[model samples]
Target chain A: MSDPLLKVDNLHVEFKTGSIITRAVNGVTFELNEQENIGIVGESGSGKSVTATSILQLIPSPPAKVANGAIYFKGKNLLKLSSKEMRKIRGNEISMIFQDPSTSLNPVFTVGNQLIETIRAHKKVSKKQAKQKAISLLDLVGIPAPDKRIDMYPHEFSGGMRQRVMIAIALACDPEVLIADEPTTALDVTVQAQILNLMKELQERLGMSIIMITHDLGVVWETCDKLLVMYAGRVVESASVKDLYQQPLHPYTWGLLDSQISEGQNSAEPLASIPGSPPDLSYEIKGCPFVERCPYAQDICYQETPQLNETIQGHAVACHFQTSEHQLERKEREYSDGDAT
Target chain B: MMETLLEVNGLKKHFPVSNPIPFKKSTQSVKAVDGVNFDVYQGETLGIVGESGCGKSTMARLVNQLIKPTDGSVIFKKQNLIDMPAEKLRQMRQKIQMVFQDPYASLDPRLKVGELIAEPLVIHQIGDRTSQKQRVEELLEIVGLNKRYADRYPHEFSGGQRQRINIARALTLNPELVICDEPVSALDVSVQAQVINLLNKLQQDFKLTYIFISHDLNVVRYMCDRIAVMYLGRIVEIGTFEEIYANPQHPYTKALFSAIPKESPFEEKERIILKGTVPSPLNPPSGCHFHERCPVAIDICKTKEPKMITKEKIHQTSCHLAD
Candidate 1:
């Protein structure tokens, strides 16, 4: 309702491999409001991580060029910022939690040292104060006996504990927005739930907006307030969590949901897998990005790119046939029936 | 009723932690897999679900005798795999194959896909060189990869395709039981479905038995006929898919099911939110391993271990409250 904390408009990212330029993020646009939890869901290589990395100017240059885009963070144009200014903003005002904590964390450094260094980099504080803050942050993220464990190296910690340490470092600066890329993918279900719940609690406590990038729709449903469905370097659907799940207008969204075998479902029933692999993003395309894999793709869908049309309350879907109320009704009927038992 | 393919009783694997303290001689052992027991029925997928460090992977490896069990017995086809000799174990390995989690890491980079698939057949002396090549092509086709792609190396294939190649290699020997440890966990959700479907197809076509080990409950719910929920290196609950999903007995099982993200547009359930990490395996709780984190823990749970009791027909759980 209020002005977005971060607004991305017409963002296009291209990766050049010799003669070929792959459009990784093509004309993508979205906004994250204050205290909002938004999920960017897509299969691997769909540019979901690339788009998130672009927000913080973390993308590698030469190979990856933000061909055209406007990234407005808190009314400031992040794309236009100088390297010095960007450095000040990165890890100070915005922090990220990467997928693999084992790799993200320096194996040589003690957890305490990393946390203290991270805190001291952004703020001018005494060593004692910074160490205290580090221990506190670790305690905040549910690490046990932060004081003793802080001195241990990353190898000493288990996978779940290492991820918690990553979270602690990410939240050390108390940033306005936290971008977590597949934060729980490497974790088990119990630990995944713990981390997700921890993130939710921290969000409430700090009142910081979150941009969670994951391919797991289950994570999105459990944690995110808004959902952004990506396909082939584009946003095919975006809506509030309730609106998106209750009545997913896009066929791609339908396929993603249907492919998920719910806990209560009959195990013997075959999962309705989407027919084909994700389209290759190497070449440019004119029509809908999802047309190749979309079961409901029509001739019109292949011929022209569809705009994000508001089909229902706060729900947007990029599909020509999304306008057909009859089809929508049928889909709604099927979704409810499938969900019901 | 189907015949039992593999029966594991009180399996244990303890890796001694070498503390770098002189004269202290601290023999802290990580109880990775401590007294896990289960039966894998013929032609059925027995899903082993657990959190990291809960010893699901170790169980899979122990069942295949990749690592000798520290204790207990693995009766594969009435043969004690734990005590089997090297020669006989090699023969047993042909009937029990393993598909690892990371396809890229599991596959040999230098070997061509065809050779990779044919290696298993050659080692087991299943067929001659010409026949092995033909069987490799057939295996490639079965796993949904084109026969032409067999000439390419592992690095050339995508993650999903590489996994398919791994599956094809696993099936080359026509092993009756396959230990697929987190096979699709490393893959994309969409690609995961593709791999899962291919696995299902292969199981049906060959009547293969699968020991599906993963941390994902949703995946286990989908692929397995029966599910075992493991915690602290022990099975807390075991039941048919229907019974477990419908009426999960153990508190741990209940929490696990509730943790799964539901797709329906309904109000979120109040997660059990267990407190504290899993206890240190070396110094696990005296009685119930889950007592420290169990919301419904009783006084007796702290003092005495609860043996797994049959709650219903073929449905079993190890909880003091259940008893």
Candidate 2:
């Protein structure tokens, strides 16, 4: 196979406040292929957003810093690039859409103005030509009556409409990679479906790879090809969506899957939830980050940290007892029990 | 047959908009909760599922009398709460409690966890200071929190733990009916599960009824016995969870259910994507509020309003073309 489009190798990010330092993204490594969609799933403060922001070198400095790692896109390490060189590639090669569209958009500017500005920033085009392309981009995102709607401010559009505007702006420069961080989270379910469908359709038409960061498994199930389950600061599991859902390896993945209130769940039974919250990122840890929450954590879990290993083809897991028969027996018992106290 | 704990009859809440012109009275009003009706059976959960601005929260507020309704009556335990005196209503509030969304915003920053939970007991004069403190400690243990942590502030706890404290505060009054408005939407899946399981267990131990409001269909399906699907400040469908899931009569309900992403990626769902956004409540569509976005809307749906039609023993829907 040809080389991957984007390679993120052993990335570590941290934030410092005074003398205390908080490790946000610790040794997260993954690759994105051409036209492939990847979903990074995790709870709040699990470092998924930090990983995505670090790709564009967007983490605010002074407090936020990239301690180590390399982000290679098209045989270029983004971290080593100068501010001038990076600015050219930031939005031209890789663009991002944030969770809340209402805030991401400039309240004072018209939708057309923002889209045209993004287009003009990356490409040498006349104002008239940029306006024409902006109108077409708005139309491509399924905004009704793009000619008239283009003149309206951000507050005039609905939540879903504003999200479409955000996507249009992100795609204005025709970036090869689009990073969407919870793009559909703020909208209604029906609206979320519309946005997801729009995103899928756009990916097919534009042939661009996407990095989708969200906490919803259902969203990933419908949209993503590969999945990365993050806990605390590290990736606990990574595999194709189908394989990971069918035969998950890590205990964190199992807990996440079981915690969901599925359609087939009995109302009388209690949901199996992870018992404890995520660990504090400011303190140094000697072992697994999820040791406190994992029901099957043993002495080794507290003493040593496990590395992400590909036990099967294209499926990686980070757990000390991932491939043991004893773990299999315990997993079976846990599944049979169904309820966690 | 289970007894009805609360009956809402033709409830309506409208906020009149001020006239843009000077010295002019405005005729326009936002009908936030227009003509909603439902019953909460004793020891049962009734879910209200709808999109934002669909009046789910407004209806919850109207039921608990946090906001007064423009019309209709709320009958709780054979007494009309709408017509009750303020003093009588204050006493009546002991039987009904509410847990709001946004755990961080719902709690006061200055108060300790124990004081926050015991505030209801202190207001109602239910127990002495010693007994209230003991009750707070007991509630902390019941909600699976360490008793010593009650002396700490709300900022010290995580989102799930703060939610547990909120649940404990709501239960302090021993309210027969608890109104949870989008309780788990803000939480992660793992923490959401913890809160949901806690609510379920508390209901069983206290023999409580719940009015669960949320936009998530899966959570609503798992938590509620019967559900009412709201649209544009009105209920489009109401039925048992099984009946609604198996055979949804309203086009809006069908579209809403189909819009939910499938549980597994391998399962393909025939999505019924609705055309436009929900209409503004200031002036809902002349007839059916959902006709503008309904896929199977007919001529009658635009000009003539549809009434609730009973399809099965308890399943009911309002749609011109349901038959």
Candidate 3:
């Protein structure tokens, strides 16, 4: 489909400290289309953030390195790009917002100053012109009375407002791709709703593609079109939001959906949480990383690591036993049958 | 009839957050837990669900006597704990304990896991060194920890394992009422399930009463028998989990429930998005704390405070729209 807007193929990122090495992002691959939103879902240390950071060359090289794979954007592989070329593309083509807005924005600097500097860095605009653009960007993100709020320091704004400021800064360059890493995680649900709605509005107005990284299924369900579920370090499943939720094939995805404590999910038995803790990233995996936690794990699952296989035309799952017989309603499956123990 | 374990009536805690500048004589108070009321029934779990700064943590602290209330009283076992003698309060603390969020921060890194778990028993002088060590080992096993690992430090364990250690420590005193403040929020969904199942089993075995505080409605719904929805330092609604989730009367409660991203992307339901942020508790809307952000707020809501009203049996709400 017109060489998808951004293609991340077989990407691998690793972190080494002393004698130890961690496979942070293990051969993750995906594509992002123009105006499309992709959600990457995983718990802490699942390598979701590592994959995002590797795309921008943001991971520090001493300890962090991309061992294998390529990230192609606009027909050029990001891994092959010079630091200068990557810098130009970072804000002008791709921008990011982190989880904590309070730290993302410098507390000592005025919010307006940060936004103005970001605009000038990516565009050939003067101080006066960039300042004007900064005010409008703030206005665009729905910050009330942008004229007055523009001059306020980062500490002056509340958590939600600081997040809005972060968004305004990210949109300053009008990047074609916006990568938000847990943007609304720090805010409360009501405020998180506000930020999510603001993002939807901004995406429509800017027509920018977004890669949303989050653990909340509901946030992904509401914002993203395609969803990727990550475990230990690799993607276990990828599909359209509807397909992923409706007919999830991976045992890990199945357990994750049932693990959620959602409204109207009132079953008598304990939550169908995947048993066992997350797999360690430092250790090299001989078989499936999730074999320790998978309820349906069998001899095949423990013997070999499954490759990402397309079970349906648009849906892909990485599981040895993602057959029709194994696809039972999450509620009906006895995930708590103690196989994981 | 259910027996009441803890009764809180008109509990208030105001922190004077005045501008810290010379020549400014402002003494404004942040009503962190203002005029809150609830009853935790015997052997039942009561969930307190609210966003940050909504006083969920403050209310938990108040019940545990970590902070004294500015007004009203906390009656546990029909004894007002407000000004209980230090010796008496220390004794009462054995019947009530707390498990905090962020296991990494809650646990002391310097101490061995066994020493950390046995600290409570040691302080209360419940058992001598030998018995305390044995009890610590037993508690570790009950929470699904390897007994040998107790000799290791806190940093050696995973987040889920540390949390289990926290539970082991909290239960050392055999507290009848446990306040689990966001106990599972920091853990992964898989680990969260392990902890949830552990807590459920522990409650049944110990016959413990729980005051579960969390921001996740789904977790609260699953854990609590009755739920209290808080906003701007006040409970806007309280009811059975079924009553609250299925049919919420309060506008704030309704909007809060709708705001959750649906379980499935295909599940279509009209989402009710609330306007504006929660008003500061320092000057809480002058009347209904939620009126500023309430979807169906009336003119009277701007000036007249709404009292907690029982719309259905055992279901209480504080909204003008409830009538």
Top candidate when judged by TM-score against the true structure? 2
In terms of lDDT, which candidate is strongest? 2
Identify the candidate with maximal DockQ: 2
Report chain A TM-scores, every model.
0.94, 0.96, 0.95
The best-first sequence of candidates by TM-score reads 2, 3, 1
True contacts kept of each: 0.51, 0.73, 0.64
Regions more than 4 Å wrong, model 1:
A323-341, B19-26
Q: List the residue pairs that clash in candidate 1.
A: none
State residue A271's C-alpha deviation in candidate 1, in Å. Answer: 0.7
Model 3 lDDT per residue over B26-122, tens place? 7899999989999999999999988889999999999989989999899999999999998999999899999999999999999999999999987
User: What lDDT, from 0 to 1, does candidate 2 have?
Assistant: 0.90
Please, what are the lDDT tens digits per residue for candidate 1 over residues B222-242? 889999989989999998978
Error of 3 at A299 (Å): 3.7
User: DockQ values for all predictions?
Assistant: 0.45, 0.62, 0.59
Q: Which candidate, 1 or 2, has the higher TM-score?
A: 2
Per-residue lDDT of B33-151 in model 2, one digit per residue for the tens? 88988888999999999999999999999988999999999999989999799999999889899999999999999999999999999888887999999999999888888889889
lDDT of 3 by residue, A1-341 (tens): 59988999999888999999998989999999999999999989999999998888889997998899999998899899899999999977899989999888887888988998888888888999998998898888888889899999998788998999999888888899999999988888878888998999889988999999999888998899999999888999999998888788888887788778766555357777676667778988889998887666779888899999887878998987774345433445434412132
